[model samples]
Structures are given as structure tokens and as C-alpha cells.
Target: MPVAIRSGVAEPVWFVLTAIVFLVLLRRGQRRATPAAVLVTGAIVVAGSLLLPFVLPPVADDPGTGGPGIDGAVNPLINLGDDLRQGGDVPALTYTTSSTQGVYLRLATLDKFDGRQWEPADIDPARTHDVAKFPAPTGLTSAVKRRTLKASVQVDDISGRWLPVPYPASRITGVDDDWKWVAGGLTVRSRSTSASGQHYTASFLDLKPDLAQLRAATPSPVGMPLDVSVPTGMPAIIAQTALRVTANATTEYDKAVALQDYFQSDGGFTYSETAPVDQHYDGSGADIIAQFLQKKAGYCVHFSSAMAIMARTLGIPARVVVGFQPGTPASVNDKRVFQVSSHDLHAWPELYFAGIGWLRFEPTPGRGVLPTYSDPQAVDDAINQGGGTASPGATASAGPSSSASDPGGASAAPSASAGAATATDRADATPWIVLIVLLVAIALLFTPAAIRAAQRARRMRAVARGRDPAGNAWAELRDTARDNGWAAPDTQTPREFAERLTVTLASSAARIDGLRRGVETTAYARAPGPIRVEDLRSVVKAIGASTSGRDRVRAVLLPPSLVARVRGDEE
Candidate 1:
């Protein structure tokens, strides 16, 4: 047999041995020994099979070890699919920062697009520098205002060769690995170490360029030659769409903003993690972008890649950055923390300007924050209303609707006022909706108990009216026992059932015996004496009290007797 078949052959051999043992025992006039002999044979076979792996020599190429490795090259589009398909929110890392703005911890950059998929750029030795100290950010001039912010990060469950750091980091300390920095992007990575158990502090420059500065900036390829270049034989729709979307824009910043708006808001695009996969274009390839533009529905990978590729077509330096978005806020050890999870894995585009270097642009709808400066409409509205240009410290808003709802350059004040009112209405109604849902759930949870209580009450009323008191009491006693998980079979007589209950309900044995006698006399005797309804009630109570606490609660909340009666399992 081939190794594949041989490895799984134990089960068939064990079945054959068990069958042979049963036949041998039966033929030798030992019919009673067949079951035991077969069982013994199966046990021995299973025990022996457990040793087969240890006895057999190992195979050279084990298929189990061939998965994505830490620090190994991975396709960002495929990684996004895997992350979205995950069933649970698994924590990847956590960080604490004083800044109120959301933090984007970039892990890697995919600048190389080969018409099939996007990959990390080839690491040039000259551009890669030691991580002991970082050089000044590339192409960042004094015109763009920036402030230093410190964040303490703790890695929890993620494993990768690339370290998650805030972009444009000035310095990082407390990492045990010998990490290195790629100068142009300022991304950190290690050649051998994994980011499995790391606690590090990073000091990064939080660049906040005003709208005026970005508009005046020009697209420069002085150092980032690769970021600006699009591969040959690429899809024509990429460039064509870019030209059409930004046809009204003049500057590089305006063109970049237009591209972001097209994908994020204006293009009729909706975010769906599974749409691209179902449509057979789930990749960051040139062809994938062309299809994505037509379909107009995909997750962050499609949105970011389309924007990045479109920007490159317009002679702007662009790349796709893979990392985590700002995570949910939590508290640990009485300290505030932002916990990032596998579900937070995201991809966004970075477009470069001459003086501003690489500026982050959010082209994915409903995922990350849309920077205030990137929203040209918001900036223009502020200036028109005598508020001046948006402040550098102004907080960015989230979602595609963060900017103007009207793309034709209309005043957004009326729409903003209406939206605020609708939001307030929803906020006020939320608690009432929750309360109604909770009340309905509680009612449904105790429906069985309520029905059972009503049935008992009806039976007590009938007994009080002298309508077969002994028969009603007997039925109630049996139901009470069944609800507490002490059921009596149909074959058992009332006397036999009462005798069995005498052991557990020793203190109430006399009451149980009297009830059983009353039921027998009522069924058999033609002129039976009247039985007191009080004696029947006392007997049912005794049986209920004899049960354990857990059984008592279960009987009240979800009695098994009701279910059994509904299924016609009880008389």
C-alpha cells in the first residue's frame, strides 16, 4: 500500500479482527462469549494501533508544516479574506496612548503590483537601516506640522516577523529582537525574530498637514521611484477611471482626494467581505481592480488596492499598507487600553506628496477614520463659514459620510442639522427597544413554568368542586415526580410507584401510601368514600420538597413533564 493508504489502514484491520473473533467464538459452542471476545479484540486492536506511528519511520516531507510562516511573504488580499473569515474576535495586540485620535499600527507595505497580486517591495540593503535609531522621515519638511506621541504596545496573540509600529516612528525601545527599519516607509521588521511576545514603546511623529499645505504640494518621485511606477500590461480601466474621476481636480492633493472619495463614497461602492470572493476577483491584481470598479462592492482590500493603483496611474506615488485599525477601548489593571484583534486587520492606501512624504488616505468605507485634511469638502466648508482652515489638531471623523453628503459642492449645513436630529432620535429610542426585547425574552423563558402552574391550579379547583379528587391528586403527584426527574414507567402500578418513592421521601412515605390507597379505591371501589383534597395537595408538596435545589429550579423554569406530555410520552 502507498504511505497515504497505509497510514489509515488500522481501522479496517481492527474491524476484520473483531468480526473474526465473533465468528470463532460462536462456532466453538461459546455463543455467550462472542460479545465479550469481540469487545476485547477491538480494545486490543485500538491499543496496538496507537503505537503504529511510533514504530513507523517518519516521512521526509510532512504536509502539516507547509503553511504561511512568520515574516514570510504573504498576499495582502488573501490575508484580508482569512482575517474576515475568522469566527471569533481574537486579540492580536493592545496599546495605551494618551492621544485621543485613533492609531494605525502598520505592519507591512505592498508596493509591488505584478498584475496578479500585490507584494512587499524588495528590501534594498541601502534603504534598510538598523533599528537602534531611526533616521528622519523621508521627504517630510517643516511645512507639514507634526507632533511627537508615545505609545506602549503589548503583543498578545499575533505572530509575524514584521513589528506593528505607528508610521513615521522616530525611535522604538524595549523590544528584545534585533529589528531593522526600512527608511522610505519607516516599517520595522526582523530577519529571524517573531513578534509573538513583545512589549515595546514607540515614539512617532503624528503628522497633521493643513488643507492649504497639501493642496500646494506637488507629487515628487525623487526618492520613491518604485511607488510611482505602474507595471506594464496592466488593466486599462484603472488608469481610465482615475483620469475620469479626477478630471475636475487640478493639484496632486485634489486628485488624490478625488480618488479616495470615488471608492469611499461617490462610486456607489458598498463594503462586503465576501463579494469579491463570490465574484471570482478576490485579489489586488490589476484585473481584480478593473472588476472591482465594475462590481462596486468589496471589503478594505479591494477598496485600498483600487485606490492605490488608480493613484499610481495618475503619476502619484502610492502603496497598500496592511495593519490594524484603531481597536475597541477597554480597561485592564485600572489602566485604559485599546485592544486590537484579528478582526481589525485592515489595508489602506498611502499617497505621497513632495513636502508631506507619504500621506495616509482612507478609501475604505465604514472601516477607519477619514482624516479631516483629506476631506476637501469639510476643509472648504470650515473656511467658507469664517472658521478658517481646519485646525491641525482637529479630530478626524469616521465613515464615508464624514465629509459632504452632496458631492456637487453644495453647503452641507442643512443635511448635517437633519442628520444630527435623526441620530438623537435613535439614541433616545435605543433603551426602550432593549427593554421591550428583554421583557419579551423573559416571558418566553418562563412560558413552560407558567403553563405548568396554571394546569396545577385548574386541577386544584376541580378537586375542590368534588370532581374526582383522588384521581386528580394522583395525576398531580406523578407530574410532580416527573418534573423533578423522577419518572415512573406506565407499567408500574400506583402502589408500586409509591413504594419506590418511600426510599427518597422517607419522611412523607405514610402520606404517599395513603394517596396511593385513595387512588386505588377510587378506581376499583363502586361506592368509594370521599377523599380530602388537602391530603392530595400535601402529598404533591412532599415529593417537590424531597428534590435537590438544582432540580427544584429546573422544574420551576423548564419542567421536563410539560415537554414529555406534549410529545405524547406520558399518559
Candidate 2:
């Protein structure tokens, strides 16, 4: 079987595999005394390990029903993102929901972005108490007419520490005592019990709010605010894309729906596990989100991560859910059981709206059904006006909900009678404005380097044109030496500088002598001769070779002479 490097085990396994390869190479190197063998072996080892995870042998060719055997050391929760992104065709879990329509079973929510990765703000296993009910879905009440969904899940081959459950799970029964409620993502987790072979029933509330009602709901500015601040150094394309996609959207709800439509429908994003397109974002994380948007192809992780980040860029609190989608249905003794395989492992984005709570949206195509309320033509204007019966899925039965809702709801949607319009507009503009400011700040960061490079180029051109070329070349050499920590003053004569260089760059004495003679003739001889470009090049190359790699790099990048000259010009 091709080694399908499990996400959690990839690092340690790579280390061990590499060490073994090294030891074998070391033994051979000692016996043969051929250093070339070691270098070739090292390259092979690196290439092999990197390509190992992606290799799919005949056995792996069909990852049907279950994943590779699980070792207790791997926590599937943390590795879920990688697993789903890898697009393995293994079994994850199986479940039977009372409703025929498939629902997304969430495992966890990631919140923080440190430019490169998205991780949960905190995971304190101690915070989970053995509670029967979570405080009722934040905004759900008798008024919302919530419907309850019951699901029975059995782990097949996947072994993860976290139990997958639908959002706002009201209760869970029939599981080991180890399961605890985690609040960050409103998920149930257990470190002691792997999800494999475990069975449990979860009851979650399905809140069905009409599109107009959702569009009208104003997210609170305080108390678990949905407005997430974008981190610094994030790619500017994220915010720019978010704004451009939702430019005509008048409400946060509309902007979110617009984004979903763009990704899932009109956006022309292709669904692929291997990122059929090499340029597509292949489930990396926050930093790669911009690339994901541009490439428009990837598996669930790419779709979910991109949508969530875009939502955040629009100042909406959004999160990516790592979970399994409702899978193929099978009949077991008259009971409709959904057989969720590892192949069904999926992710989607959820955006929080005040009054309505966290609403899920399906941005990945070919994975799950899009909610009906998201469809504009299906939305009844009378329903949004609170006159018609609840929207198609509002009754909360276990069936695929229709995405029928006001398509242009945001366009004609009325704002709250008070100061809502101004506040909403400001909220919508904050992300773009912040992005603009950040872009300006980033350009300023490289301003000094850019100025130094220009100054160096200008002076080099002047010297090449024979404007006291030998003297200028000598001056350039002295400045380079000074920048690299050698003390050379303008007051020194050409011969004196050459002597100093002879001591420092002992191997390049001849080159330095030639440069000194040229400078001396140009500066002092009654009849000055043009300096040879070949001689100047040789002396510069010799000086560079004499310096350490670190100093040479710094001299080229932040040449002190050019920087000083630029500063002098500024002064």
C-alpha cells in the first residue's frame, strides 16, 4: 500500500524515515568514503518523504468506507482539516438523522489567524462540563419556532478525540462518560474516547429564519460581537475580493449570501481533491486564502477557509467547520441510516447574525445542498414582510431546506428605523478602509530599501560613464568596506586604502594594487588616463569574495554608502 501519511503522524514519521535513510547513507559513506553518495541519498530521502503522503497505490486508489487504520497517537480533530483536504476516500463516520436532508456535523471552529495558519483561540478541555443542555441557541426561543433534529452517529474507522455534532446541539445521549461540551465551537469533545465504534444521539435545533428577517437582523456591536477584526499582514486581495464581490450588497446578510453564491454557483469554482488545477488553493490556511480565491478550485477546506476569511474581511464573525456531510443513505431494518464515509469528510463556512445566531452556508459545490433561503426567486416578499407562513425549511423537519429567499433582499431591504443606515454603511466600509491603510503601511516598509537601491544604481551609472571613473570606483570600494565593518575614511589616499585592503583581503592584494594605481593616476597624475572597467570589476569581485556571506548579503541589500548618500540628498 502506498504510504498515505496520516496528518498527525506525518511529522514524526517523516523524522523517523529520514533518520533511517541518513543512518543507511552514513554507513555506506564510511565504507565507500564517497561524499557524493551521501549528498545523493539526502536529496532522495527529502524528495521521497515529501511525495510519500500523496502517493496512492492500488489499495489506496479506492479509499472506500474507512480510512487507513488508526493509531492511538493521532488526534483526528486536529488533523481533520488536513485529512479532508487530502481528499482521501476513507470512511470517517456514519449517522442517521431524523430528517432525510443531510446536515453538516461540525467538529470544531478555528478563530485566530497569525498570517500563516488558523487555529482555535483556546481549547481548554477543563471548560467542558458534563452538561445535558447548552444554554438554548443564543437567539432561539418560542418565537423562532425552532425544530429539533435527532441524529445517531457511529464511528466507523476514523479515530478522533472530538465528537461531531450539529450546531446548537440541545442534548447528547448514549456515549461514554469522557465526552465534554466545548464552548468555543459549541462542540462536544473527549480525549479519552476515540470516535471510532462510539455511538451517540445528538439533538440540535434547526432555526429557520426568513431571508428578510435575517437581512434585517442587526449584529450586536457588543457581547460576543460578530464583527471580527482582520489581522495585520493578511493578503490585501482577500479584502479587495470581498468588497468587489459584495459591492452592490446593501446588508451584511446580503454580502454573505452574495459571497456564497459567487463561490458555489456563479464563481466557476471547481471541486477537486487533488486540486486538479495546480494553481488552486489546496487547503493550506489563512495566508493562502488569496491564492485560493484566484485559483477557484479545491476541496471542502479550500472553499470553507476562503469563505470564512472573506466573511471576516467584511467584518462579520465567521468560522470554518471541520466535520462530515450527510452521506449516502442506506436502509437498516426500515431505519434510514446515512453511511458517512471518510470521503464525506467536509468543511463549510458559518456567519453569525444577531437575533438569528450562527447561520451555515454551503460554498462547496458537489458536497452539500445549498440552503433554500439563499435563493432569491424562492423567497416570498410577503414572507419577509412577516405575513406568509414560515420559509420552506422553517418548520425544521429532516429534509434538505430550500434556498428560496429574496435574491435582491439586500438591495430593497429597509434599514432599522433609527440610525441603522449610517452605522451599517460604516460597518461595511471599515474592512476596505483598513485594508487600504495596511497596504500603504506595507509599501512604506520597503521605501528605505528602494531608495538605497536607486542611489546605488545612479552612482554606478555615473562611474561607468567615466565621470572620474577610477576615483569613483575607489570611493565605491571604500564605502562597501565601511558598510561591511571595515574603517575607511575619505581622507585616506588611494595607496593607503589599498594597503588596508591588502591586510584585510590578503589573497586579493594584486587586484587591490591595480585599483589603487588607477585611482592614483586619475587623482594625482598630470595626465589622467581612463580607468579600465575590467580592473574595477576584478577589485569589486575580490572585495566581495573576501567578506562573509552574511556581510556580503547585507552590503548588497542595504548598502551603507548608498543609504548614506540618499540620506545626504534628503538632508
Candidate 3:
């Protein structure tokens, strides 16, 4: 998940809390080196930082309500339907294309279905640095009229580590060296740089398959191995719906076209940002599809996930694509550019047909461009049956509810004024935002122990710098024993402690006496004796060797002395 930086007074609040924790820790360390105050104060800082975003209300650069799974990856992005529904008209990214048609740059292709949501499968580790002349499309050939286009993209505040690139990109320029080509999805991703602030130009070839050619294409069994696996426990309604909808269609392409028409047209489903009340499938995967089937109302995530799952259920290899829709057109330097906003963030289903390879479908209502090859008769039938036009932006309220007055309507023109997230939009992002906070809290809980270990290491290093390294090493070992529930009383003299060690740990008696003699010589003599490193290790090893296996393990893992010091509950 991307860390959203919203402009608010939360920054000042964060600084104040951090300062308080540091000051409290410093004061406590000076007194008794207790970590209780530090731990409590640090926990507060972590929790407060997480909650402040929600409490302060979203400001500029606010990442609108995240749907489910959207990252910066070029493949395997999932759970974006909810974000599509919940987002306000925030800017996502902008692009300038050589062609008149809007270009849909893909983020990731999610193929793995874990019953709850769709995710990307493991990709080949072999990465290509060069983006010039990628592997050719599997089945596309010279017969198809391939349109070559150059597109320059500029990312705004979008988060995630993946770079967005069009399918079958031939060349890319101006990308950082960290970017790598992932073969399975044919998308580019960065090893470090995020999608935000990315500026690059991509050269891609778009093969527009004719409706007839797609319809005639057969299903290849080999290609089906990628994304055609459907979970066994998938709702029966999904399979039944796919069967029922495509019953009249004969070819694989037509079956796909039929499913598209069923969802976008004849199905009477409306485009809305909110999920239906009676249907509770807000999460992803098979269960969400079941709820989507019954409700028939959701944003793009629901529609895309459902269609992809349905295609797989019908034995067609399908995957969901997460990316920005070709945004609204704008003129810059007399060239046309598409301004994709956060609201333009979308997900759609793509199905693979043999010979034609993978082709995209627009099942998401009022959200994406309709594919060029949808069956004309079926599309008209859908329109006649109260299904709207194939336009991505249908005329509906700009919020959560849907409007059926104009389905299959023309794409809604992007508004010039659409910018910052509203109060309502900020409110929608609250739950997921809180989840991020809780994760931070879990990480912060171990802060005190980590700090104490670091301090002990520093102290040990400082002690080693003195003339009596052996004596200091002995003292460290004694403290270690004390922390791990062994006896290391301050009242015992060095010789007395050595005698006690000989009795308690019989095997280490000679080494313990040697260490004690060194300590006594360093303390009593004006000129300290030279230190031997092995004397300290010899005694420490003997002590460890004498303890039971369970006690030795406990001493290393659960340092009772450190815990007692932190709690100011020394025993």
C-alpha cells in the first residue's frame, strides 16, 4: 500500500509527539535507564501519527479511499473496484498520445484467485533492462493492422512501486535504471522508484482485432494454463450466470462478448461508487462475485473482478488489469493530452482468445471505453433492454448512487474543476486508513526492546576501549547472566563471585578464577595488566555450557534482566 501524504496540521502534531517521546526517554535513561516511559511515549507517537490523518480531515494530495489492491506494479494488482467507487475526482496521472483514441496503460494483470480476491502470481525472475523491441505478441501477426503510437506520461501523487506501461510496449525512454521488464504481464516495474513523479515515453503497438477474426479464433489449451483456473467453491450463480448469458453465443469470443453485453447492457446493472446494501461482497475474489451477481450494482472493481472470474469459470484465460483510464482530453502546445485523475483509476477484465491473444473487454459500467469489437446486435439488444451505451462515463450522480436513465451513454466529459478530495471522500478512506495505523502500532510495540539492545551493545563497545578489556568483558558476562535470571549480586567481591561461579558452574571454575584474577590485578595495581580476549570468552562459554539447554535458550531469547530494567521491576 502507498503511504498517502495529505496536507494537514498532522505534521506539527507528529513532530511534537516524537519530541516528547525522545525527551521522556532521555530523562528516564538519566534517572534509572528504565524503558517504560519511553515505550509508552513511543507507542503514543506511532498510534497518534496513524490516526491524525483521519482525525484532521483529508487535505490536498489526499489519497482517496483505497479500494482493495492497487499498487504501482505492472502486473498482479488487485481489489481496485472499491477504490474506483470510493475515489473523488483526484488527479491520477496524465498522458499525451500520438493517436486520437485514449490509451489505457496497464499497471498489473491479476491471475491468481484466492477465493477472496484476485492477485498476481509469481513472475519470472529473469528481468530485461532494455525496453526496445519486446517479445512479440503471442499470436498477433502482419495480417492485423497494428497501430504504432508514442505516449509521454507524467505521474502525479499516485503511490506504488510499479510503473504503468501499455501492453506490448516496444520501447521506453527516460526511465530510471532500476526499472525492469516483467515478462508474464509485459509491464515495466521499478525496483525502488515509485509510480509517483515518474516521467517517461513509451512506444507501443496496438493490434486492433476485427470482430470476425476474434469470433473465429479458437481456444488453445496451452494458453489456458495461465489464468483459467477457477476455485471449486466459487458461487454456483457465477457459473450459472456465465452459462445462461452466453447460451446463445457459440464462439469463445462471442461468449466473452455476450458476458460483456450482459453486464454492461441487457443486465440492468447500474454504475455506482457504493456497493449495494443487501449484497455484502465488498472484499474481492469468488465471494464478492457472488454478491455482485445478486446486487448487480458496484464500481469498476466489482465489475472487472466478476467478469474476469466469470471468464475463467467459462474456461477462458482471463485476468484483471489495474490502471488509469485514458483521461479527459486537454490541449497543451497544440497537442492533445489525456488528464487521468484519481477518479479515473480503474480495473477491467481481459480474456485471451487463441490466435488473437489477449483482448480487453469493458464490463465496467460508466467507467471505461467500450471495446471496438463488441457484437453490434447484442449491444443494441442491451440498449433496447434498458442497458446504457458503452461509454465509460455514463450520466450518473458523481457520488455513490447509480442512474439508469442513460446506460450505454456517451463518456462523461472530465470536468476542469475536479481536483481536491472533498470531506465526504476523506471520510470514505477512514477504515483502510485506520488499518494502516494498527499495523504501525504493532511494529512500534517492539521499539523499547530494540533500543535497550542497541544501548547495551554501545556500552559493551565503550567498555572494550579501556586498558582492562578482560575485566570489562567479565563484567559484561556477569550482567548478561544477571539479565538472564542468573545470580550477579553487587555485594559479592570479584574473588567471591569467582568462587561462587566455580561452585555453581563447576566446568568453568578455572576460567572464572582467571577472569577474577585479571579484574583484581586491574583494580589493585597502579599499572593494569595486559588483557587477553580468550579469558573472557573461556569463562562465558563455560557458564553457558554449564546451564541446561532450556535455560541457555531462554537466556538468549528472553532477556529477563532487560525486561526488569525497562519495567523498573528489578529482582
lDDT of 1 by residue, 1-571 (tens): 2322223223434444554576566547543333333334434443333334335763321112222322212323344555666677667788887455447777777776655556666433243476657887767888766567777898776555667788778889997446777656677776656676679988777666666878988887555555457889987888999999999999999998898788766888888877876776666667667888999988777787788788888988777777777676677999878877777777778877777777777778877666656766566554444332233433324432222111111100000001111222233343454345345445555667889999898888877887887777777778888888896777789888999888888887777778788788888888654566776788778778878788998787767677666545544
Name the Cα RMSD for model 2. Answer: 15.1
By TM-score, the best candidate is 3
Error of 2 at 41 (Å): 24
List the candidate 1 regions with Cα displacement exceeding 4 Å.
1-77, 123-128, 221-224, 377-571
Candidate 2 regions exceeding 4 Å error are 1-88, 139-142, 225-227, 376-571
lDDT of 1 at 529: 40
Which of the numbered candidates is closest to the native, going by highest lDDT?
1
Candidate 3, residue 110: lDDT: 65
Model 2's number of clashes is 17
Per-model CA lDDT versus the true structure: 0.65, 0.58, 0.60
lDDT of 3: 0.60
Better candidate by lDDT, 1 or 2: 1
Residue 454 of candidate 3: its Cα lDDT?
A: 69
**All candidates: CA RMSD in angstroms?**
19.4, 15.1, 16.0
| Residues 176-286, model 3: lDDT tens digits | 666776655666666556667789998877565555666777755453546467777777999999889989988888888789888887899887655542344454456
